[model samples]
Target: MGWFFAFFFLSGFCSILYELVWLRLTMAQFGVTTALTSIVLSMFMTGLGLGSWGAGVLTRRYGQRVGFPSLRLYALAEFLIGCSSLAVPAELAWGHRLLQSMTAQNAYSSGSYYLASGLLVAIILLPWCTCMGATFPLAMAAIRSRQRLESKRSFSFLYLANVIGAVAGAIAPLFLIELYGFSGTMRVGTVCNVIIAVSAFALTLGGRASARSSAPVLTPGERRAVTAQPKVLLVLLFMTGLVTMGMEVIWIRLFTPYAGPVVYSFAFILISYLAATFVGSFVYRRFNTGGEVDPYLSWVLLAFLGLLSLLTSDPRFPLNTPLRVLLGVGPFAGWIGYLTPMLVDRWAAGDPDRAGRAYAVNVLGCILGPLLSGFVLLPLVGERAAMLLFVVPWMGMAFLPSRRQEALPGTRMGTRIAAYASVVAALALFFTTKNFETLFPDREVLRDSTATVIATGNGMHKRLLTNGIGITQLTPITKMMAHLTLASLPQPPRNALVICFGMGTTYKSVMSWGIPATVVELIPSVPRLFTFYHPDGATLLASPLSHLVIDDGRRYMERMPEKYDAIIIDPPPPVRAAGSSLLYSKEFYAVAKERLQPGGILAQWLPFGDEAVQSSVARALEQSFTYVRVFRPVEENGWHFLASMQPITERSADDLVRRMPAEAVSDMMAWGPAATPTEQFDRMMRTDLTTQKLINRSPDTPPLQDDRPVNEYDMLRHWTHYVHSGMRNWKPDQYGAGSNPPPAGESAQKGNE
Candidate 1:
């Protein structure tokens, strides 16, 4: 029994590690759109469901006649899963290459692209995920054959250990990836799986009985009971899976603002959820004495808990981020943790086939939940209302009329009262609570499948926020991003490209050069909200000179054939944002180099980061470009990295101003603290920084790469610095006064305007 627990604990750890790594790898290969993310996750769950059901069928038909111990089959499954760690990366790379070739031959629409990429991903991932799903039933069969009494609650026992292991997995991989790259981290998972397989196989070889199970020959009464279990149990399991996973997607969107957009923010949410779930499952295992919990009361509690996030997430509330996540998500996730295995155990009755079927039904709901949330609910109703809709099912289930046989005597009135009270509380929360958008009286809010965008503030204070995190503001800094790089060229740019269209400021500035400017924005709603920030936004957007492509910037560059004289990349803020490394990585620079014409410049806007991140990004640029120049923005504390394959001339302020056209000069001074174009150019030039100076801050730090996102996974480094600084009473002011700089756009003072 101890060995089974250990086996499952390690198995669960490996499963989550694979999920995190694979999802990231697929995003790198495919585009990083919401739809692509949903497809990858759904395919993963689908594979698990198919494997569980198929394994159950095989066990039911052949368990009694098998010549070897069932544990050997479990070991074989683990061995295959371990091998996947090596195979999957190569397979994904091949699929990406194939898609690229197809894309080149035919101009694929967005729908066609998704279809082709999703099919390729499903083909690559399904087999390995199936092997992951089969572990449950195979282990259950082994336990049933060896120990009859333990088999009765084998599912819950394994579930508890798995959840515990999952909690560790949620926190461990961040540090692992920080030390090793993605492929190296995967190698660690492979080694653990191999150890589990070797240990399981050795146990089977040590004279374990190969006997057919005596418990398979069921009596007539037992057979009737097994066949007659209520189908509603399956429905309940499905609902739990759907609601829990859906809420997770919503939580990320709602909490990102308060927690900041770093990778640690996501890890904190997952840790809270999995840790609380472990407690619930542990309590269930300790207390399960063949007694049933009250279904009506449980449903009522879940329905109310489902709305707890509304109160905690409200801007009017005083809770901090960690408190908000814990109070909002903990109780609801814990209740689900308690309910899921209980229903599965009751329905399965120690039969591997029945448990497999029940578990697969749950996984089916898991597969659909994120898709429904990302595609349908979030885009249509937004986060607050979508959460309200998720609660409706649980509320309805709580009020469901009970059959006479199932109803407990004298408890009906209390259950009814609790159910009514929960509905009232949910309604109250819906009516009174204020979301992040409501914090500003003057704001335009828009929702799309990708993000929730809010254009808020007035005059120079105007800002663009996606999913509540402020992206960019109306400032001259954005204008300089276009003019400074374009004017530095000895010859005028023929055409240009802007990667991120935040508030359309840079895109608008680029157009002032009177060249064809193309802007690629990830969020569709962000482009639509341009008119909210600038009065001439609609006019600019309607002009023939402007072209808007709503897609991931890296992906757009990969597929598009047109080369630009200047490519300006202002990746979304915070500098340590999850997936931001993709833009700053060495591989990304290699791609950008391919898209630049001879003597073209690539200007990268890095809002803010610590020494390690700054050094890593600086090193990447230094290695990628022949000539690289770094400048501190005149108004804000951040870098503007200008890199070019050709020599970037060090022109004087007057020379730079002379290079710009009349319209470009006017646009540069439109929102400036400077009185003239030469003054504006001079102010920027005064802050010129060298790439070598930036890299010298952390010489040991390697260049940021696609495989190793040093900026995103810096929790361990930050922690170590915090401890040493505290001991020495040091005031770390390299980037700012505190351990973390103020979130990108927030750092600039209003006086700067």
Candidate 2:
């Protein structure tokens, strides 16, 4: 019995570890878009739901009639789970190769590619995910036979262990990935599964002769006597599952902007959710009443969650304090988490078949929730409102009439009227609420699966906002990215790749060169907003030599077959943004280096504000290339890293002007500090930084990687420095900027005005 408890704990731990690593792997293979994330989550839940249902049917029909012990079946399921762990990573790699090959066939459509990839992901995850579901039923059967406790009570013990293990799962990656990387961590999970399988088999060996013979434990009359209206209970549980899972998606979107879109943000949300759930389930076990809950109290609690969620998710509210961590996200997670496992625990009544049956229905609800939240709700209403509106289902579920209603719901005229009034008041307050969205007017809003893009400005200038955080505005410094890289290359560039397409500034400048240029952008809405900022954006996009593709920057480089003379990347601001480290990782630089032609120049934009991040990125770039040089693009806090295999030499603006093509020279002068190459060259000469010295600035600082993203997960270390010292920004004072000072420039700042 003790061994079985340990096995369940280990199973829960490995389950979460696999989920985190698999999601990372999938994102690396496919672009990180809303549609892709939703598809992956839905497929995972669907496998679990089906597995639960199939196991229940088989247990009731065959195992009940023979001398089969459920412990043996449980052992078999654990072994199968272990077996699938070995195949998951291999299958993902093969899928990437297959998808890349099929992309070459012009006869196949992009839709077909997406469909095939999704199907492949589903096939890879199904076996392992299904076996995960079967463990619950099989374990319950063994517990019920060996122990003399109520079947309902045993479920709570196992659930508590599982949720506790999940807390470890959410947190282990921060350290594990830093030590082992993604592949090594997956291997660790595989070993844990083997231990779980072995423990289960050992238990089976001891009980081989003592296995329960096939016999109907509970007659129909007995089952009906225990509970009434099974279908209604199932429906209520389904709605419970739906609201809880859907709200997670909505809350993640709501908080990303404030949380800097880092891995810690997602990890914090999930950890708090599971931690709260563990507490909720533990409380349920202590307060067990052996009866259906009073339906009147349930409705009131559900209604309360609806109202509280509004305050919790609103940005205008003062939720930035440290306590905001608990106050902001815990309300909805606590209430919903408490009610779900208890509902399943109560409905199944200690019977393994009935337990599996009810839990399967709940898992199916989880399958659809993320899909609807990501695709339909977020795109239509935005994150805050979408989060508030989804609570309507819980309200409906609570209002549902129970067979035996306690507390006299809808009994007295005044009570019923007052209840209805309160519900209306909550909805009205949420609807007319003055959040950041409702308070600000006259802003252009665009929504898609990836993000909510808001455009705002005054008079002649404009700014782009993604999920309420300022991404960037129209700026001339962006032009330096295009012209400087082209002019500095040993040979005149024939073609280029721009990783981020912001306001079409870089792309437009690249297009002016009259060479083939492909711009890869992650957010679909970002590219669509191009024309609003640049009137000539449509014209430039129509050029035969220009192309815009929506893709993840790293994945694009990996799957790309062609080489380019120059590859320039301008990632979105606040380097710590979730998944942003992928663009700065040493592994990514290696891939980009391999894709660059001989004498090719790869330019990376590093935004200053965090020295820790700067040190990590600089180290990654220095490690990847043989020769590297850094230059401050303007007087601002950002630097451009120029790297290549070939030796790089400095040249004056006059020297560049003498070699520049007539049209190329015109493009260079169109948007920078200088009207001629000589003027631009003078400003660049003042700000050149030695790459090796910068790498040594923070010695032994770890470089960012896919698994251990130093930038994404190290907020605590960085914030500690921010709290005590008066430093809000990482100043460049340590390394002097001016060798030969250029006079104050106003053309760029004036245009920004």
Candidate 3:
């Protein structure tokens, strides 16, 4: 039993690792967007469901002798998973580089890129994902065959072990990712696979040692015999699996939009699910074991929980944290605890020989839940509302005839009424708590007639968490220095581009200057509903001067045809989004340079008070552009960068301000270095350093484009900077003991504001 659980847990881990990295690799390699990634995952999930069902059929016909051969099958599957993963990165890199070398003059032919990438994904992932889907159910059958139990115990124990394994799998990846990069993780997974196969094979050998037949357990005759089933039990299990699978998939998908970029919401969701499953098994054992009550009611309750949990979709959903926690831990445990044991017992039929079939069916049910959700439900209503619709299954579950009613010695109307009232009360609270408006301040309360509320976090205490990284606090008066800096730039710079539209501050700033600007933001919600919180948000969203493009900035620039006079990369630092690091990469700068007209400037905000980070980033940027110049708005704070395609001739601070557009010039003279009377302003530009050559060379570093990719040096750069910043109270404006002092310049002050 212990060995079975161990192998099962390890198998779960391998499956998740394979699934996660496979999707990430596909996206990076082939540019498979979120929508397509969802499809691929759904397909794998569907396969698992089918595999589970198939395993059951295979087990019953073959008798209890299938476990020994199943171990070998498990080993082979692991080998396939490991080998495929190792081979993929190399293949993709080779193909991509080969294409680049061939198309030196033209970048890449779109047809060739898609063809090679698609072929690569199919070759590497399709078979592996399929194999992963097939493993769990078959393995469950093997374990169950070894553990002879009563009908109910058969299914219950199998699910219990599988969930335990899932818990183990869910926790290992975090440490694994840190210990080994993606490729290393795959290798480790391969090793884990080998271990599981060995253990399972040993178990099979032991189980068979005392038996009659030793050759692969399931013979041709036995395979044919497994077809007979209790139709009622199979139907019930299938429906239960299908509904649960669909709900899980839908819930997981829906989380992508609301879950912050860095939070690893899917992993969190999976972990919670496994945890819940484990808890549910224990809870079920304690409360409902020994056939005390009909298992159907418990399942119905769980199905209901899965269905009604969709109310957490609102952006203003106040209890996102608690809701997410529940989403993770609740339904999975509830369903398993209340529903799965009954299915197990039914299949086991008070016999240990049939335990494998029961376990296989339970696993099949789990896979089916996600498969149906992704392929059938998600496509129909989209991820969000589809989750809400899961309620239909729950409500339907409630209609199932309770065996308790038929078998109970006595039933009182008063007791039934009291139970009904309690259930209603619990459900009412669930609905009310989940509703966004009920949890957070209403739009009307936040509407300030005096000052246009620029942007408020959607929920009470709702911090703007992008990709799981927190960006800003949700206080009424959020800091506007960053936005104001962009806004205060000179008016009508001919053409301008801004990336990262937090609160639409940069957009408003550009509009104020009357510059025709394009904003590229990856999140869909930002541009669509920016004005809902702030009047300026609407104006910016509605601006004719503003063109909004939903894309990664690096991607947008690589394909952009027109050149801009000023490109403002107001990326929310590496703090908010890991993807932001790509913006700071040398390849990114190269793309930025291509989009700039001659003498045009690219202004980037680098949060580097630390000299090392500043130096490394400066070195990386210096590799791409020319005339890298930095300006400090005040002593020990506010570092702004202005880089150009052409050299920027040295000029007095006042003269430079005067040459700029009126708004920018006014800003420079006012709240800028000129405005801060107590602080000193300075210029930091390395004249001798060649910025262009710093980024472009290196046979090892791949040239970044819309298709080709680059290493994530920016994450390291940010970490390095953060470490140094913590050590030193590093201020951008103030020069240090060893640092160069501010450039000497006496300029005529203009009270432009």
What residue pairs are clashing in model 1?
A: none
lDDT of all predictions: 0.83, 0.70, 0.50
The best candidate by TM-score is 1
Which of the numbered candidates is closest to the native, going by highest lDDT?
1
Residue 545: error of model 3 in Å? 5.7
Worst 10 residues of 1 by lDDT: 731-740
What is the alpha-carbon lDDT for the whole of candidate 3? 0.50
- Prediction 3 TM-score vs. true: 0.65
Better candidate by lDDT, 2 or 3: 2
TM-score of 1: 0.95
Which scores better on lDDT, 1 or 2?
A: 1
lDDT of 3 by residue, 269-334 (tens): 667766776787767666666633353344334534654455555445555654755754476456
lDDT of 2 by residue, 19-111 (tens): 888877777666565666667787778777877787777666655555556777887887887776568878888988787676544334335
Please give the lDDT score for candidate 2. Answer: 0.70
Give the CA lDDT, 0 to 100, for residue 379 in model 2.
87
